[model samples]
Target: MLVPLTRQKFEQLIPRIATGDQYRYVWGKFSDFLRRLLASVVAVVVVLLLRWLLGEGFGGLLLPFGVVGGFYWLWGPVLWASLRNAQYRKYKYSGFFRGRILDVYISEELIGREETVNNKGELVYVDNLERRLNVEVGDETGFSIQVQVPLRRSHKGIARRQVAEMIVLSNRADLSNITKVTDIYIPSRDIWVSDYPFLQRDVFVEVSNRIRRDRLESEEESPRTPRRPPQRKEPPQLPRQDREW
Candidate 1:
C-alpha cells in the first residue's frame, strides 16, 4: 500500500527534519561515506551479474551501463530520505524547550549540481540552492543558543531582528547535541499570528517586554562621557606696586 505524499504530509514532516550539524558530525560523515561505498559496490556487482547472464549481447552491453548510471544518480537523494525518516522517528519522542529568537541570518551553501531532462529530452545542469536560517535564541534565564534551520530559497516572511517563540527538541542521550526547532511563532508577522491562533496575546506581550528591557540594558552599558577635571585657581597678583624703589 503506497500512499502519495501530499503538501500536508510535507508540512508535518518539516518539523521532524534533522539539523545540518547532525549530518556534519564525524559519525554522520562516516555513515554517509559508508552508504555511498556500499551503493557503488552493489551497483558494480549487479552490473557484472547482468553482463554474465546476458553474455555480451546488445542488452547486456548497454543495459548494464544504464543500470549503473541510474543507481549512482539516485543514490544521494535516497540516502538522505532514509536518514530523515530515522531522525523523524527519534524526534517524535523527544522533549521540547521554549525560547525566543534574538537574531537571525541566512547562510547559503552550494550542496551540488543536479541534472534533469528538459522538455527537449536533453539533460540540463541546475544549481541546487541550500539556504539555512541561522538563529540566535535565548531562554527565560537569558542563556542564548544558536541553531540552524534548513530553508528553501523561495521561503519568505523571515527577516533579521524578528522575535520568535521557538519550540526546540534535543537528543537526551547527548545533551550537547544540536537542537532541532520543531515549531516557531512570530508575533510581528501577521501571517504567523493568523496561522497560529492558539498563541495567547500575553506571550507576545512578554516577548516584547523582554526585548525592550534587553535593548535598554545594552544602551545603558555603553561607554559614558568622562568628567572634566576641575580648574586650579591662581592667587590674585599683588597689587601693582608703583616702582617705589
Candidate 2:
C-alpha cells in the first residue's frame, strides 16, 4: 500500500533536490525557447513585408530595426499570455484530491539499515530503501507527490522531499503552484489520502472522499459486469422418448 509522507520525512530527503539558480536556469531556458520561437515567426513576417515594399539597400537596414522593435513589442504580451496560460492550465486541470492523475512512476524499492543523528545527538533509525511514488496534480498550476521509503522504517522522507522541492521551485521560479498537495498516494495504505493539501482539512477530506466514492460507484455501474445466464430445467423424458422412437 502507498503511504503519505510526513513533513519531517520530507525535510530529510531534501538533499536530493536541486535548488538556487539551477531552477532559474532551467525555467529561463524554457521561457527563452518559447520567446525565440514566437519572435522568429514575427521576424520572418517583417522581412517578407520589407523586401516586397522597400527592396534591398535601406530595406535591409530597416528590416533589422523593424524586427527588433517587433520583438520587444511582442515580448510583454506574449510573456503575459504565457504566464496567464500557464496559470490557467495549472488550475483548470488541477488533479487536486481526486482529480485526474497526470502521471505516475514507480522507483526502486529502498531496503537495508542505517543510523543517523538528529539535532538532539540521539541515534535515529534509518532504512536503506523504501518504495518511491510520484504523483502530479493540478492543471496549469499544479502540485506533485514524491515519497521515499526508508530501508528500516516505512518513513517516506524521499517522497516528501520531492513534494517540497516542487513547491519551492514553483514559488521561487513563478511556476504554476496554485495549491498545496498533501493528500496523495500514501505508501502506508497504497491508497490516496482522503484530503487535498492546500484546502481546509475538513473540506479537503470531504471533497476527496466524495470523488473517490463517485468513482467507485461509477465503476460499479459499468456495463462490463457479467450477467447471469438463464437457468434451464433438465429434460426428464429423454430416455423414454428415445426408446419410443
Candidate 3:
C-alpha cells in the first residue's frame, strides 16, 4: 500500500534519525555498545543455566553454536543502528545548498528468496520488488549530485527537470568534493524529502524564500548600467529681438 510521509510515518521510516531522546546523539554509540554488552551477559547466563539442566554432552555441543547465534541476534541490529545514527549526525552538520533537479528516474530491482533444498529436492521461487527514486540535482556552481529518495509507489508521478534544493556535505567552501545529499526540496510540487524527519513544511518554505532572495541579491550585485532619465529639452529661446515688448 502507498503511504504518505507523515510525522509518524517519517519517524518509523528513519528510527536512527529519531533517537529516543535528543541527547542520544552525543552518547548513542556508547549506549548501544553497553546495551549489547548487557544482552551478551544475559545470554551467557541463560545458556549456562540450560547447560546445567541438560548435562554436558548435549549442552556442550550447543554452546558454541548458541553463542554464535546469540551474538548475531544481540549485536547485529545494535551495530547497524549505531552506523545509521552516525550517518544522520554527519548529515545534520553538513552545509545547505540551493539546487535544481536535472533529471529523475525510477530504478527497479528484483530480489529472490534464498534457495532451500526441500524433501523432493525441488526449487521454490519467491521474488520481491524493490523500487527507488533517484534524482539528479545541480547547484549554481555547476556541481551536480544524485540523491536517492526513500520513496515508494507514492512518488511515481514525480517528473524530471523540477526545481529542487539540497543539503550537502563538502570538504571545501568551493564545494569541489561533495560527499552526500542529506535532503531535497521540490518547490513546485511542495514536496520535501530528506534522510531525516526534520524537514518540515515551514522549513521548506523558509529555505525556498532564502534561495529566491539570494538570487535577487546576486542579480542586483552584478554589474548593470543604471538608465539615466531623459533630460528635458529646453524650449527654443524666443528670438532675442522679440524683446520689442
Number of the top candidate by lDDT?
Answer: 3
Off by over 4 Å in 1: 1-50, 53-76, 95-98, 105-133, 148-161, 165-167, 171-245
What are the per-model C-alpha RMSD values against the true structure? 21.7, 20.8, 17.2
Model 3: runs farther than 4 Å from truth?
1-83, 88-93, 116-121, 139-141, 150-153, 194-205, 214-245
- Give the TM-score (vs. native) of candidate 3: 0.50
Candidate numbers sorted by TM-score from highest down: 3, 1, 2
Write down the TM-score for model 2.
Answer: 0.23
Estimate, for each residue in 41-155, the C-alpha lDDT of model 1 and write its tens digit: 7777777777777777756466757566546633454445446545544542232233456777778867799999999999999988787767676654445667565664433
The whole-model C-alpha lDDT of candidate 3 against the native structure comes to 0.55
lDDT by residue for model 2 over 20-106, one digit each (tens)?
322333334557668766776777787777777877766767777666655653344444444432432333212222223455455
- Error (Å) of candidate 3 at residue 179 is 0.9
Winner of 1 and 2 under TM-score:
1
